[model samples]
Every structure is written in structure tokens, then in C-alpha cells.
Target chain A: MNIDLFFIPLQIQDELSLQNKTVIVVDVLRASTTIATALKNGARAIIPVASIENAVKYASTLEPGSFLLCGERGGKIIDGFDLGNSPFEYTEEKVMGKTLIYASTNGSVAITKTKYAKHSLVAGFINISEVVKFVSENSDDILILCSGKLNRFCIEDTVCGGMIAFLLTKGKSRKRLNLSDSTVSAIKLYKFYSKNLLKMLRESEHGRFLIELGFEEDLKVASSIDSIPILPIFSDGVIKALK
Target chain B: MNIDLFFIPLQIQDELSLQNKTVIVVDVLRASTTIATALKNGARAIIPVASIENAVKYASTLEPGSFLLCGERGGKIIDGFDLGNSPFEYTEEKVMGKTLIYASTNGSVAITKTKYAKHSLVAGFINISEVVKFVSENSDDILILCSGKLNRFCIEDTVCGGMIAFLLTKGKSRKRLNLSDSTVSAIKLYKFYSKNLLKMLRESEHGRFLIELGFEEDLKVASSIDSIPILPIFSDGVIKALK
Candidate 1:
């Protein structure tokens, strides 16, 4: 199996290059975790838009109350939006049976870019096992794409990406698995911080930013491994939980 | 001091942002090592150009015998160039007192992009201590920019960048040095690969390609710490050893 991991989505110059490859988009601080939570709590589907304007535009097309305008900018809820990026806000009571037009600073932009991928799955620590199981059973070429903060390297995303790459290649012969340099580095990072993921999150630059903004609890939710055991696959402009 | 490391120069969106900041360009596989070797062996100065056409165009502006056209395409010397990107080819007998118009695959492109930097220095394991000394004594806001292979992550550059970041913050209080995520990650990678740089190079994807192309000796020269022991600084479109 060939496994290539990009520390940031900017490394992917051509979106068409993702065609025929199974892509796992990771935004560990929130997006992946939030999406999985929304799906697990019964959101009908998620339409990941690149910008807030697009999210609002998409929301206008849907029947009122059938779809919710959701997302965040600068770690806070977008103006006049239904919900922010925190997973805790994506409760079953708030999201059940409704579609979410999501726009985030990093994750949604990354998820939308993978529209051409054969199997595009959103992943985070909370839903890693489910993502791994899906890809392991059905993938030969995998691209673990980290939705870095504004196209810059972020530790949480890269570490989550590393964790995914580590899990996928564990117990596999080194010669059989073609891991890229980024993959190797990610695995090394994952091993270094795997013991205390919450602490790693607490120390990351974005994590620090979030903490200052009163989202410390969000970090705890994001750090909980397998807490939301579901795979949210993005395809045809909507992300839905795989049955 | 604030230390930020970019895995690839592409992360630097605006050249103006590098203004007033010391930028260390690292391409450990060859370019950084080769440039430092050239300067240490008495090359007058290096004009790093982004492309072969630019190198050729710049050569036409220089006196015929005073400067040499040099660079590589795919690990091999460009057709009709004076030298390949190997430190061995930069003997005093060949490059003494002559300006080199260099246009390598990655390193030169990265160096040229830092034209707005307050202090832009080329770095490799060969001249790490010298480069570190210069930056430590003369810098505050430091950006260690790795010249990754074609804007994709390469272990050697990141590891070398990591080594620089690690050395810069070796004994400093964690609270004193403001390290970015990329800087922190580079430090970790450097710690992991510090013990066996040569072996790490041999196992690296770019290294394997060079070995297949018969440039294994170049890797050996590149991995040798402080072998060249010269700080090559880029300014006003030319790279010269800091006197």
C-alpha cells in the first residue's frame, strides 16, 4: 500500500490528483470531531462550504428549519449562524434530522477540496478507529490530508494525521508499505505525543488560541479517542455517516 | 526570541513578510551543502536563480570567463553547466574567485524568494554550527525555511531545520522562546534523527534517488557536521560567505 501524508492541504496543488485515491481529511482541533458528532447525533448530511458567504447562500436554498447554517471563523461562531465549530454544540437535540451547511476556517475548505477523491472520510481522534476500519478494508492508495490552520502547519492536525498513518501501517511489513517523508514524520510525532494527547493539544498554538477564547472544554472533547465512533464520508457535496 | 520554521518555502505567502526577519534556508540533501562548500573553497559569490532560464539569462549579463553556469535538473548536472550539485565538484581549482549562477531544483528557488529578508543564510549539516552562530548572535525573529523537494515535505531539510531550531533553543527557558508548531515539530524530528543523519539520508526518498544516480558521496559530504564551516548569506540577489 502507498501512503502519502501532506502536513497541509496546500501541498495538494491539483485537486484532480486526488482522483482514485482514498483521502482522509483531518482537522483534529475541531472540524473532524464536530462533523462526526453532528452525523452521530443524526444530522441528515453536511454541506461543507469554503466560505461563510457560500454557507449562507446554500442555507437559503434549503427549506427553512430543514437545514442549519453552521460554522466558525477565528474559533468563534460566524455572525448570525446557527452553531459554532465546537462538537459540544452539535447535540442530538439541536442537529437531529437537519442538514448542516458548514463553513470553517480550515477544515471545511479542506474537505471541499477533496471532492474528487474516491473515498473522502473526515477523521479526528474521536472517530479514528471507524475511519481506519473503513479505509483499511477498502483502500490501496491513501492520502492523509491535514487541514492545517490557514494552510500553515498545525501540530494537532499533523499529529492526528500521524496517528491515522501509524494505525494504518501498524503490523504491516515496512517494505510493503510505501510511506512518504511526511507520513514518517507524522508517525514519529504521533508516537511522541500519543501518551498524552490532551496535553499536546493544550500546548499547541491553535489550542492556546482556543483556550484564550474560552474553548478549553472543546479540547477535552476533541482529545477523547473513539468517543464518537463514526465515519463521516464527504461525497457529492454532502457528508453523511456511513451505514 | 520567536522561532518559526516552515517545512517548505511555499508556506511563506508574501516575500515582504520576510522583511526584517532572519531567514535560514535549508536544503540538506545538496543545495545548502553545495553552496556552503563553494563559499568555503573560495568561490567569489553565488547568484541563486529560480529556473534554468533565469540562470542562463543572468549568465549573459556577466563577463564570460568570470562566472560559471551551474545547477541540476533531476539530480544530474544540467546540460552544459559548469558543475553538478555535488560538494566534490566545487574544488578550489574549479570555482576559485569565480561567481556561480546556481539554479537547482529546490534550494535556489527558496533562496531567491527570501530577497526581502534581513539576513538570509543557506544551511546544511555541513555548516550548521557556523550558520547557528551567525543567527544566534545577530537575530531575534528567526524563520528557518526548508527548501523541500518541489514544495513537498522532505525529511532531510526538515531534520536539518529541526536541528537548527533545537540548537537555538537548547538551554533557553521554554517560556522565553516563542516556538511555532512547525518549529516544535522540527525540533522533535531532529532529536529522533540526530544520532544517525547518514542512515536517515540513505533511507530518505530523495537520498535513494541520488544513490541510484551515483551521487551517494554527496550525501556523505552533506551529512558531515561543520565540515564546510562557513556561513553563506544571501543579499541583493547574491550569496556570499559572511566575512
Candidate 2:
């Protein structure tokens, strides 16, 4: 197995290069967590748009009451949107059976860029095991793409990526598995911070920014491993829980 | 002091943003090591060009015997160039008092991009202490730019970067120093690998490639700490050892 990791979407020079790879997009705090929560709570499907204008445009095509305008900009709910990026905003009662037009500042942009990937899945600590299980059983070439904040590296996402890479390669022979430098570094980082993920998140740049924005509880939710154990796959412009 | 690190040049969206910041460009495997060696051996100045065409174009303006075209493509010397990117090729007998129009695949491109930086210095493990001493005594806001191989992360450069960041913050309080996620991660990676840099380089993807291409000796030179002991600063389109 060949496992490669990209710290941010900027590392991807050509989106078409991902055509044959199983791509796992990670946005630990909190797009991946929020998406998995929404899906587990029974959101119909998530249409990830790169911009607010696109989200609104996609919303106009759906039945007025069937879909909710969901997403965040700078860790806050977009003005007049139904929900922000926090997993707490995605309650069972609020998201059940609703289609979401999501437009986050980073995660959605990264997810949309993987439209050409063979299998694109959204992952976080909440659904790491599921994503790993899916990739381990079905993938030979994998790309762990971290949706870094605005094309810059963020610790929480990278640590989450490291955790996923560590899980995927655990017990595998070093000779058979081809790991990129980023993958090797990610695994090392995962081992260093795995003992206390919440603390690592709290000390991260984006984590501190979110905390200042009154989203400290969101960090706790994002740090819980395998809490929402569903594989959210993005294909054909929509993200849905894979059965 | 605020310290930031970039794993690759792609993260830098605006060159102007680097203004007023002391930028340390690291390409540990060869460029940084070779440039330091050439300068320490009595080269007049090193002019880094982004492409072979630029190197050739710049050569046309220099007196024929005064300059040499240097650099590599795919870990081998470029066709008909004066030298490959190995410290061994840059002996005092060959390079003394001559200007080198250098154009390696990754490092030169990264060096040229730092034209707007307040002070841009090339670094490898070979001249680490000298570069660190210069930056520590002269700058407040710093950016350690790892000239990652082709805008993708390379272990050697990043570990070297982590080492620099680690040294810069050695005695400082965490409360007073601002570190970016990349900076923190680089420091952790440096700590994990500092004990045996040569072994780490031998295992890195690029390092293995250079080994395969018969440049194993270059890795040994690059992995050596402060062997060259010179600060090669880039300014006014030339790199010269600071007197």
C-alpha cells in the first residue's frame, strides 16, 4: 500500500492527479466532525460548495424547506445561515432528514477539489476507525488530505491526519507500505500527541482561535475518537453516509 | 518573538507578506549545503536562478571566465553544466573567486522567491549555528522557509527547519513567543529526529533518490552540523557570506 499525506490543498497541483486514489479529507475542527454528526443524526445529504454564493445558488435549486444553508466563515455561522460548523449545532432534531448546502471556509473547498477522486471520504477523530476500515479493505493507493485553514498548516487537522495514517499503517510491514515524508512525519506527530488529543487541539493555532470565538466545547466534541462512526463519502457533488 | 515556518513555498501566497521578516530558506539535502561549501571555499558570490534558462541568460552578461553554471535536475548535473549539486564538486581549486549561476530543481526556485524578504539566508545542517546566530541576534519576526522538494514536503529540509526553530526558541518562554502550527510541528519533528540526522536523511524519499543516483556522500555532508560555519545571505540578487 502507498500512503501519502498532504498538509493542505495547496500541495495538490492538479486535482486530476487524485483520479485513481482513495482520498480521505480531514478537517478535524470541525467540518468532518460536524458532517459525521449531521449524517449520523440523519441529514439526507451534504452538498459542499466552495463559496457562499454557490451554496445559495445550490439552495435555490432544492425545495425551499427541504434544505438548510449550513457552514461557517472564521468559525462562526455565516450570516443568517441555519447552522455554523460546530458539531453541537448539528443536533438530531435540527438536521434529521434535511439536505444541507454547506460552504465552509476550508473543508468544503478541499472536498470540492476532490471531485475527481476514486473514493472521497470526509474524516475526523469522530469517524477515524470507519474511514480507516473502509480504506484498508478497499484501497491500494490512499491520500490523506488535510483541509488546513486557508491553505496554511493547522495542528489539529495534521494531528488528526497523523492519527489516521498511524491507524492505517499499524502492524503493516515497513517494506510493503510506501509512506511519503508527510505521512511519516504525521505518524510521528500522532504518536507524540495521541495521549492527549484535546490538549493538543487546545494548544493549536486554529483551536485557540475557535476557543476565543466561544467554541471551546466544539474542541471537546472534535477530540472524541469514533464518537460518530459513519463514513461520509463525497461523490457526484453530494456527501452522504455510506451504508 | 513570533516564529512561523512554511513546509513548502506554496504556502506563501504573497511575497510582499515576507517583507520586514527575516526569512531563512532551508534546502538541506544539497542546495543549502552546497552553497555554504562554495562560499566557504572562496566563491565570489552565488546567484540563484529559478530555471536553467535564467541561469544561462544571466551567464551571458557575466565575463565568460568569471562565472560557472551550477545545479542539477533529477539529482544529476544538468547537461553541459560546470558542476552537479554536490559539495565535493565545489572545491576551492574549481570555484574560487567565481560567480555561480545556480539553478537546482527545488532550492533555487525557493531562494529566488524570497527576493522581497528583509533578510534571506540559505541554510542546511552544515551551517546551522552560523545562520541561527545571525537570525537570533538580528531579527524579531522570522520565517523559516523550507524549500521542500517541488513544493512537496521533504523530511530533511523540514527537520532542518525544525532544528532552526527549536534553537531559536531554546531559552524563551512559550508564553512570550508566538509559534504557528507549522513551527510547532517542525519543532516536534526535529526533536524526534535530531539524535541521528544522517539516518533520517538516508530514509527520506529525496535522500534515497540522491543515494540511488550516487550522491550518498552529499547526504553525509548535508547531515553534518555546522561544518561550513558561514552565513550565506541573499540580497540584491546575490548570496554572499556575511563578513
Candidate 3:
């Protein structure tokens, strides 16, 4: 198996390269963690829009009561939207049986860019094993795409990507995969920060910004490894729980 | 002091942001290491041209016997150029008192991009302390620009940048500097790889490639931390040893 990691989606020169490959999109701070939580709470489907304008336009096409216009701009719930990006806002009572129209600063853009991928799965610290198992079982080439904050590198997303890479390569199948330089670097980073992930998140730039906005609890929710086991896969232009 | 780290020069959106700031350009695999070696061997100066066209045009204005046209493409010396990017070739006898018209795949382009910087210093594992001391004494915001191979992140350059950040912040001045997420990330990576610089260089992608070309000795030369105490600063379109 050939495995490569991109620090940010901007590094991708041609989206066509993702075609027929398993592309795992990671956004550890909130977008990915919230999406997984929303899916676990029974979200029917998620329509990820790349921009706020697109999110608003896409929501208009749906029957008003059937879907929720959900997203955040600068970590705050957009005015007139139904939800912010915090995982705490995605409780079972709120997201159950709802169609979430999602847009975020980084994660949504990365997800929509993967429309042509064979398998684009959402991942974070919340559902590590499920993603690892999904990729291990599939024989396709893999691309771990970290949805870094606004086309910049994020330590949290990278560490999470590295953790996945490390786990996948640690098994007996490790000898079969060819790891890229970025992939090796990610694995090294994961090893360095695995001791206390919550502290890492709380001290990160994005994490500190979220904390100043009074979302400290969200960091705790996002750092619980393997807490949510559902695999949220994007295919056919929509994200659905991989049942 | 405010410090930020860009894993690759591509992260820099506007070059003007580097103006009036101290920018440390790092290309550990060869360009930086080779340049340091040439300067240490008593080269009069290094004129870093961003492109092959620029290098040829600039060399035309110089006296024929005064300078050497140098650079590499695909790890081999460019056609009609005097030298490839190997540290060994830049010995005392060959380069002493001769100006080097330098260009390379990544490092030269990155160096030219810092034309507006207040102080643009080249760095590698070979001269970490001198670069650190320069930054520590200066009050300007620092930007460590890693000249990753072809705009893709190279582990070695980043690790070297991290070591600088680690040392700069590890001192009592740590509390005064506000590090961006990427800066903090680089510092952590530096700490992890600091234990075995030679092993890290030998295992990197560029390192392995150089070994295939029989430039294995170059990797050893690049990994010797503080081996070359000189600091090469780029200014006014020419690179010279900072007396």
C-alpha cells in the first residue's frame, strides 16, 4: 500500500489525484469532532458546503424544516445558523434524524474538495480505531489530508494524522506500505504528543482561541480518543455514517 | 518577541510580510549546507539568483574569471554550470576568493524571496548557535522559512528550524516570545530529532536520495551541528559572510 500525508488541502495540486483513493480528512479542533458527534447522534446526512454563501444557497434548496443550516465563522455560530462547530452542540436530542448543512472555515472546504475521491472519511481523535480499521480493510492507496486552519499547518490535525499513520503501519502489514516524508514526520510528531493530548489541544493556537470564546469544554470533548466509533464517510456528495 | 514558522516557503502569501523582520532561510539537505561550506572556505560572496535565467543574466555582467556559475537540477549539476550542490566540491582551494553565482531547486528561490527582509540569514545544523545568538540579540520578529524541496515540506530543514526555535525559546527569554502554532510544532520536532541528528539526516528522503548519488558524505557534513560557526546573511541581492 502507498500512503502519503498532506499537511493542508492547499498542497494538493490536482484534486483528480484523489480519485479512487481512500482520503481521510482530519480536523481535530472542532469541525471533524463535531461532525462525528452529529453522526453518532443520528444525523441523517451532512451536505458540506465550501463557503458560507454556498451553505446558505444550498440550505435554500431544501425544505425549511427538514435540514439545519449549521456552521461557524471564527469558531462562533454564524448568525441565522442552527449550530456552531462545537461537539457539545451536537447532542443526540438536537441532531437525531436531521439533515445538517455544514460549513466551516477549514474542514468543510477540505471535505467538498474530495467529491471525486473513492472514499473520503472524516476523522479526529474521537474515532481513531474505526478509521484505522476502515482503511486497513480497504486495499486502495491512502491520502491522509489534514484540514489545517485556513491553509496553514495545524499541530493538532497533524498529530492526529500521524497517530493514524503510526497505528496503520504498526500492524503486520507495515512492510507493504510506502510512507512519504510528510507521513514519517507526522508519525514522529504523534509519538511526541501522545502522552497528553488534552494538554496539547488546550495549548494550541486554535484551542486557545476557542477557549477565549468560552468553549474550553469543547477541547475535552475533542480529545477523547476512540470515544465515538462511527465512521463518517463522504460519498455521492453527502456524508453519511458508514453503517 | 513574536516568532512564527512556515514549514515551506509556499505558506508565505505575501513576501512583504517578511520586510523589516529577521528571516532565517533553512535548506538543510544541501543548499544551505553547501553555501555555508563555500563561505567557510573563503568564497568572496554568493549571488543567489532565483531562476536559471536570472543566474545566466547576472553572470553575464560579471568579469569572466571572477565568478563560477553554480546550481543543480534533479540533484545533478545543471547543464553548463560549474558545480552541483555538493558540500565537498566547495573546498578551500576551489572557492577561496571567488564569487559564486548560485541557484538551486529550492533554496535559491527562497533566499531571493526574502529580498525585503530586514535581515535574511541562511541556517543549517552546521551553524545553529550563531544564528540563534543573532536572533536572541535582535528585537525584530523572526520568521524561519524552510526551503523545502520543490515547495514540499522536507523533514530536515524543518527539524533544523525547530532546533533554532527550541534553543531561542529554551533560554530565559522564552517568556517574552509568543510562538505561533507552527513555531511551537517545529520546536517539538527539533527536540525529538536533536538526540540523533546524523541518524535523522541519513534517514530523510533527500538524504537517502543523496546517498544513492554517492553524496553520502554530504549528509554527514550537513548534520554536524555548530561545525561551521560562520553566519551567511543575504542582503542587497548578494550573500556574504556577516563579518
Strongest candidate by DockQ: 2
Tens digits of per-residue lDDT for model 3 on A2-116? 8889888888778897898999999998888999999999899999999889988988888878899899999899999999898888888888898999999999999998989
lDDT of 3 at B43: 95
Off by over 4 Å in 2: none
By DockQ, the better pick of 2 and 3 is 2
DockQ of 1: 0.89
lDDT tens digits, residue span B192-237, model 2: 9999999999999999999999989889999999889999999989
The C-alpha lDDT values of all candidates are 0.93, 0.93, 0.90
Q: Is candidate 1 or candidate 3 better by lDDT?
A: 1
DockQ for every model, please. 0.89, 0.90, 0.66
Residue A156's lDDT within candidate 3 is 94
Off by over 4 Å in 3: none
Error of 2 at A146 (Å): 0.6
Q: Write the per-residue lDDT of candidate 3 for residues B97-159, one digit (tens) a residue.
A: 999999899999999989999999999999989999989998999999999888678889989
Q: Of the candidates numbered 1 and 3, which has the greater DockQ value?
A: 1
Per residue, candidate 1 scores C-alpha lDDT tens digits across B172-224 of: 89888899999999999999999999999999989999999999998999999
lDDT of 2 by residue, A1-243 (tens): 999999999888999999999999999988899899999999999999999999888888889889999999888899989998988888989999999999999999999999999999999999999998999898559999999999999888888888988888889889989999999999899999999999999999999999999999999989999998999999999999999
TM-score, every prediction: 0.99, 0.98, 0.94
**Residue-by-residue lDDT tens digits, candidate 1, A79-141:** 999999999899999999999999999999999999999999999999999989998898559
After best superposition, candidate 1 residue A164: deviation in angstroms? Answer: 1.2
